[model samples]
Target: MAPQTSETEQVVDLNSWLPITASRKAKWWYSAFHNVTAMVGAGVLGLPFALSQLGWIPGIVAILGSWLITFYTLWQLVELHEAVPGKRFDRYPELGEHAFGPKLGYWIVMPQQTCVQVASTIVYSVTGGKSLKNYSMVAFIASTIRGSHHHPATYGVRSHTTAGQIFDVLNGIGTIAFAYAGHSVVLEIQATIPSTQKNTSKKPMWKGCVVAYIIVALCYLAVSISGFWAFGNVFAMPVFDMLESCLVQKLHFTPGRALRFAGRSTYVAITGFIALCIPFFGGLLGFFGGLVFASTSYFTPCIIWLVLKKPNRWSFHWIASWISIIIGVLIAVLAPIGGIRQIIISAKTYKFFS
Candidate 1:
């Protein structure tokens, strides 16, 4: 006889269609590594510029706040996965389908996923292009400092006006959100942890979160603080301007105007090819993080939790979840304005080869 089905149950046939599966042999630490790897990618490179926009103190606060918010929401996702009996979702979209209906899941996750991938690709392309050119790190660092000398207006604090500071802080929020937007990896890694009966005190998943964030925090602080210290307010989005300027300074073999023009043309062509569709790496990161990741990392989880638990309207958790959702929405709305403004400002002085 065929197995019976409960009327309340929602069927998800993902196992047959999806290639990913839980690995029984994997431990929690391994899962944590996956989480760390997922969250800590090319996004770190943009942190310096992000810091510049937000200011040192405000930037650190924002980073910590975002981390805590993201971490709490991630824990909600974990708890949601274990809420029902005999039901497990291997993918984020799968969890969405189970929480809502299949159709809502499809619409919500599809665009968000596309944006994340697109943003990540842009970040990688910019980083890779710079790396391939083999720019001297020391020269780049020095030039970054010196670049501030020529553009003093661009390098230091522009205004103490409330609106100006708000805009500046908003400009960096997208990059902050982007750097910490790897919730999908957490779900994947959690799936791999083998349930243990001998000791249940420390959940491997939680331990992994702890470890991963420590590493992520260190990396983010190091890169961001260093970048801001080196270039201050004049820090470029992709940050390759420093490297390019350094390279140009060292090039004593410029063989006349024709050769230089040819070289510049070739450099532009190469960058154009590598940059793919997006020319402004930092702006794209901010836009994508705000438009897509805010929902996936913060808003969606809170919504899902609210739906699943159906807490009292005035309860603490309910209020907290709503607050998070509101913050996410605000970030989604406000971040793009700052990103677009930054892009427009950048365009006024943008050079193809530099």
Candidate 2:
């Protein structure tokens, strides 16, 4: 039999289709918007709060350091996506599977990626609900004032105990981690762009990503600086695709509108309920960032790059990878300590569905 062409291979199959890999007609600008949107969501708003906890120097270091590290890791992921000719690792776990053994990589990466998506949905839900509520209060105040009113903005005031300050710094690191949580879906976003043998997807995807990161830097710089001075904040629908893929591809269920509607709606309802239960997630930024986002966005790519590239000893890539991993692991461990503490504190006063 003759080798099938890439065109013959890419024919859409609804039965085995997943949302993230379904669309392959996006232009470079689509990636710019998608990445910008993915990278600048609920977490961006928390950066100010994150900066406040870390103090001036440490916080600046953390922000600039994270930006640089994440950018490098992102480049590594893009290069690896098409390292093998004619094959693409669309999902993060797929890349992990390539670097490590399939089962081991899946186990190592899947949990972290899944957690990032699930936790993000919960955070977004809380942020969305509170935003409207806050807007209403502002609107009411405006009505009474009859014009624009400037209120004193209190940011970065340190009044916590010694231990509390420590926890806050750790939490702040997690918040910073949260802000750069874009790695999980980089390949997924790139997958949308059309790739050819002559012109691979990475070229266009990287171009767009560069733009997105630029926007991220501009927004974060002002937000983070002003917040500390002032304060500071993905997947292309991974949760939906993951669930549908499991049902349709893993379990051999038929893929159709009904299944999608039911599954997607259930996911929404669950995330909403969790959001309602918490009602406030300001403290969760660090917890989720450290617990899972760091693994998915910060260190996982670095580890995979080291495994696959095997850069020479003490080389630039090698040293940078190690440094990133070290910091990422610390953030994963220490940031979550404060996050869990914050959760416990919040839980004590939190009311169910109130």
Candidate 3:
């Protein structure tokens, strides 16, 4: 029989598990750029639609609130790495294993992490494809207008009587939560920053996080706030869709003869062919944020912290942890249900090419 090892004696061999035998040496700036790109993508574009659903005040609060919660949870993961003496956790699932038994780590955290990754790839692909298609379509419209028509494609704001209600708030929360979905890579990025006397790896991680998230917040605010200002509630959840819809509505859905051929060949093949999954982008973001992000970002870290640290019950730390857990659970439960409901309600009017 194999001998048992104490927590302090547990050693993970990176070469045995990881494909890369050695960590790639990189400057903190490079790693910071990687983190920023990973975190900020198509999701930034959708923030305005979220703001449309959430009122301005609530939308601002949600962005700030989620950012703080996300940063705190990220820091918790860092602390978890230091939990076992003389050992460091390089991955989220590994930390889960360290905190709980292998079952929770492999079964819960791993799957959630995988789902988050796969969903993110889908969002990126759809966004990229649609972006390309929109560019081509706009070019086609411009040429057609110059040749056969006089008026340029123009769009106007469509307003709602109310900013939003409970369902809208939930949807906005889910979408905003999804915007901060790079937690899975935080530890790995932290590991690549070579430690120095004045600057430990944690220093770079903290610096990277602060810089990246500030960019994220500003980018998100610019899109959501400006979008709401321009389009109001008339925009689609996926902001790309909102933009395309603006042009389509202005063009009255029938492309000029010259535009139709190009639209049918390129636009249809690129955007329309992929749009069922694409328009669902916003809903998927909401679903993923609630189903995975809340659990991984909010609930898991707090639970792991309490479990490993064993903070005293009814104390300030304990009470705060419990509150976080409850909020995470509530968002997880409410957001998905509301998101799916919104998707279904909107599907009746959904069009592939429009």
Candidate 4:
């Protein structure tokens, strides 16, 4: 026998079908953090590649385009929030169904959303891995400097070393993983906000959106400015720019003892940094979880709901999702990792102002 829907389930389902919902004030900070994290991560991972492939002008253009896209998305969400104050944007599919008919609604949004999630997941995984390696290397260098009391002529920072290339690949994987990992928060947001709780106050949700955007923008600008200033012409990656600029090398103390001490210190520092990064890598794992959630929890359920409740027709959502997933997996498996990196750089150039 089919399981019966409880009152809570019924309420959740109803809420899930609405267009927008009021978010908690406390969650505003969380949203700000999320936006900042995403923007910085993207900039650090994307900027160097973009600059190398498309030149500086194109790279700047791409950044601008990405910003504009983000702005438009936020605007739409705010408008939807205003229209249906008690629901979330995820429920917009249902609203589309109500307005444009089920078939049209599913076709309009699901495929685009799925693609965005997939792209996001890949970027997160790749970038996260790179950040891990970059930070680890930084710790290693710092330790070495401290150990060698006989100040080395150079702090050993190089632009396009083999080590940098390896880190770049790792960063790409981390970016993908990070993008795919974290959906529990999104799920929690959907679950906790009641359908009946509308924002009756005229205080625009856009205020919160603007605050979140500004926080993110500042973080991006800081990292970008710091990176460019430090690396100048030699900056090969966003993380590299930050590292080159943010760290300072100093020489003090007796040579022999300092050398020994610095070596040990570097070792400890490098190890600790790597250890700390394991949790950040957890974000990549969360991205995989997000992919599963997007596929099974989101797209699948939506398809099933449409099939059962309204129309009984095969649709593009299923076809496009499967195709995209297949293509993504094939690309992940078959494409040379370097090739993928190049493609990402090229695509960023083509799509954005870059």
Tens digits of per-residue lDDT for model 3 on 1-354? 999866433223322223211363656675568667766766665676777677778788988888777777777776565566555565667778877888866566777776666566666666665564332223334434443534323222223334336666777788887788777666655655565444456665677677877776666666565555555450111122222333444554532444434443453345335544546666766777787778877778889899899999998768877887888898889888657856776677765443
Please report, in order, the local distance difference test score of every candidate based on alpha carbons: 0.66, 0.80, 0.63, 0.37
Q: Considering lDDT, where higher is better, how would the candidates rank from best to worst?
A: 2, 1, 3, 4
Off by over 4 Å in 4: 1-27, 82-89, 95-99, 131-204, 232-354
Candidate 1: stretches off by over 4 Å: 1-19, 131-166, 195-202, 234-274, 349-354
Cα shift from native, residue 19, model 4 (Å): 17
Error of 3 at 287 (Å): 1.6
Per-prediction TM-score, please?
0.72, 0.88, 0.71, 0.43
Better of 2 and 4 by lDDT: 2
lDDT of 4 by residue, 22-74 (tens): 23333444444554444444324333332333234433453454344334434
- By TM-score, the best candidate is 2
Which 10 consecutive positions of candidate 2 have the poorest summed lDDT? 134-143
lDDT of 2 at 199: 88
lDDT of 1: 0.66
Q: Model 2 residue 238 lDDT?
A: 82
Cα displacement (angstroms), candidate 1, residue 56, comes to 2.0
Q: Model 2 off-target regions past 4 Å?
A: 1-16, 133-157, 228-236
